[model samples]
Target: MKLSPYFHDLRSAYQAELDDLTQDSEGKDVLRKRLAEKRKEIAFLVQMMELAPEMVAVVFHQGFRFARPMALEQLLGRGVDDLPGWSSLSADGAVVLEPWAASLAKAVLAEPGGERFLAVAAGLEFMQAHSRLAPVASHAEAEEDDGDEDAPEHDDDYDALSADDAADPHNARSREEASDNWLSDVGFDRKD
Candidate 1:
């Protein structure tokens, strides 16, 4: 799987958001409670969809049931602007909300730009899953040299990018900084 740089960076942020929501100081699982709390904040979070997507996207953690990973894989290769509309995925049955998460899905979909956010949310989860589940081989990582002769001519049409080579550090750093500053302003401790 090869990820476009946009998906690559968002995956890392998405994974981190999920991890933070996974546990509390006691180390016992609190994901459910945390997610519920986040769901309550959907209106505020909806505003974050474009700027801090991973933060907003956590509301849909485990919310998707991927019926057509192939469709999602194809999506991962493109940048945000080139992404297909959400209807394309829904019409093709590429993904659907899990029964338990339907209400949250409804809430998000009801928001302005909800369709766009859902598409980005799916891409983040797809890349995160493939990154964690797949074994690391040089070939499996995101290719840095688009012009390398040895680079596979075809991406196998599967879209997922690994952190190893899937990003522009400057962009990632700026994103991180923006996220941190936002958190600080919102009264949360900045990530170290």
Candidate 2:
């Protein structure tokens, strides 16, 4: 069975991840370098798999050097003389991965497709993990205290509680202790 669609899906996903990770020109450069590395690895995988579409396979092995995977496909679609015909199945797969694939296509459009896939995957995982850390409503409530607005600011000589302050019977704590207590109460690591 032709595995080009899997390769395409993988490549497309990587690019999408890379785009989300890299924010500046240096980051772009780093991401492109990674893409080139992935492309080379992919080329080797294709060769070992002994897939057809020899020219596409050849372009992959020969190295596109910092190019994006999607652009390479487009270039083949445009100018390659011995390109293999894309199967309808691959086209259908592309449609399924279209949302993520578009971002991947944008990231790798200009450079050669040599070794960038690994970086893409890392970026993808980071985005997914970051999305899972959002806090909840109960935690939000713990961060604020309702007070009478007309009360004058206290000018008493009371010093702020130090780090060891604990919650009092009134369910209140010194500000520093309160923050720590709130975080612990919510079962979330302060560092997260």
Best by TM-score: 1
Quantify all predictions' global Cα lDDT against the true fold. 0.74, 0.32
Error of 2 at 165 (Å): 44
Model 2 ranges with Cα > 4 A deviation: 1-15, 20-28, 43-85, 88-192
Cα error, residue 33 of model 2, in Å, equals 1.2
lDDT of 2 by residue, 1-192 (tens): 012333433332333334333345443446455545554454244332222222122212212132233433332223223332222213433212224333333333233431233222222232222222323322343344235455434311112222233235332323334445444654757643
Per-residue error for 148 in candidate 2, Å, reads: 50
Residue-by-residue lDDT tens digits, candidate 1, 4-112: 8787767666766776788799989999999999989887788777778889988887778789988998888888888886778888899877787677667778877
Instruction: Looking at model 2, report the run of 10 residues with the lowest lDDT sum.
Output: 55-64
